[model samples]
Target: MSRKEQIEKTATALFKSKGFSATSMRDLANALGIEAASIYSHIKSKEEILQRVCFNMAREFFEAIDAVEAKEGNATDRLKRAIAAHVNVLTQNTEASAVFLHEWRHLSEPMHGTYLSLRDKYEARFREIIRSGMNNGEFTVPDEKFAALTILSSLNWIHTWYKPEGKMTPAEIAHNLTEMLLNGLTSSKQALHDTYSHLNTP
Candidate 1:
């Protein structure tokens, strides 16, 4: 990895474990087996490292949503894919996920605004999918934002409790989450039929 990548990797772990304020330049330098001042060669300050870590996580989050959005399918399928991709990336990248979930609030005003803007953009992807599903008569949610938030909240919480090596594989977890979210948001006959078939089977 490049020096900047190494710095981000190390900083992500430290920030997740120690939080932004509790972690220091000396801590990162010590962890990387370099002098405190050597870190300055790669990054201007500790805040820069935090910014990179946050940006890295944001990039991953948006990329996952983009991948799902680019898929060829109905809005429901796209939403399912998006939820699965979100969980897969967050669970597989624990440090980045943690940095995203817990450390984003530490960014300065300008940086925080930038982060929030990207976050809103990414979230709009989900809301758009939900709205499309509703307009097509595939979903029956009363509030689009609340429904989208419901799905996002469920998927976002995977970073907190999901384990890559746990009993369920990523595909299984994703399917369960997609099913959970879709069921709550949509009351279409097709969805009810699928649920009935699954629930009544031997």
Candidate 2:
């Protein structure tokens, strides 16, 4: 791989495994089996790597939300699509998701603000969908923002414990999660019963 790619890949692994505050340029270089000075030939500094990893993960997450939000469908279906997309991205890009989860706090103030902006934009897409559902009497949530956060938090944390080599594929996990989230949010009694029974018995 090229030096830049190598740095990024190596940095991603270190950041995810060691966390942002704990990882150093020398650590990354040691992991890459290269001289510390060699990294400077391709990348500027450690913070730059932090920026790259954070921005790359943020871009993927924001893009997925945008893609789902732009689709033509009813609010409920669109919400399900959004949840599925979130789970898929979190599961498929495990390292990126881990970086996003663990190293986000290392970003600079301005970059942190930018990151929050993109995140809020994504959350607003869900809020909009939930708002539409409530307007149509399909959802009964009192606070759209809180409900959206709750739903997103439930899906976002799956990466922390999801095993790529486990019995359930990403699709299966997404389906089960989506069904549970939407059924609770939309008050689907039958779906809720099925979900509860499946979880309880299995």
Candidate 3:
């Protein structure tokens, strides 16, 4: 990694563990085994690091959803892909994901608003998918907004408990989770049975 990338990576770890407010440039520099002055060469401020981490994570999520949206599939299949994509992004970028999930509250004014806007857009993509499903008679949810919130709330905190060395891969976890979430929205017993059986299969 270049100096800039290395600084961002180390800062993300610090922000994840120590928090953006609690972590200083000195601490980040120390973690990088360099003088505090050296860090300034690569990063302008600790908030800069936070901004990079937050925006990069947001971009990743948007990209993942964009891929799912572009694919040709039924609502169930599209939603499954979306769930898997989300899990993969979180697991693959755990440290940054943690910082993004928890530390973003510390971001300054305009950037904070920008982050919130991006987040809303991301959530809207999920809601759109769920609404599409409901329209097609694939989902029986009474409220698309509530269903979207439920799915996002369930998946958003995986970084809190997910272990890289766990028995289940991200894809496996996504499969099981998508199955469970979809079960609640599925319109009929046959759909639920099919999902249940597929989830149980080796």
Q: Which residue pairs in model 2 clash with each other? A: none
lDDT of 1 at 113: 97
Indicate whether candidate 2 or candidate 3 has the larger TM-score: 3
Q: Candidate 3: how many backbone clashes?
A: 0
Worst 10 residues of 1 by lDDT: 184-193
Instruction: Tell how far residue 81 is off in model 2, in angstroms.
Output: 0.3
Q: Per-residue lDDT tens digits of candidate 2, residues 117-154?
A: 87788788889999998888677776999999999888
Lowest-scoring 10 consecutive residues by lDDT in candidate 3?
A: 184-193
lDDT, candidate 3, 5-41, per-residue tens: 9999988988888888889888988898999998888
- Clashes found in each candidate (C-alpha, N, C closer than 3 A): 0, 0, 0
Per-residue lDDT of model 1, residues 66-178, tens digit only: 78777799988888888888888888888888888778898998999999998888878888988898888788777888888888777777766777678998889999888
Best by TM-score: 3
Shift in Å, residue 35, candidate 2: 1.0
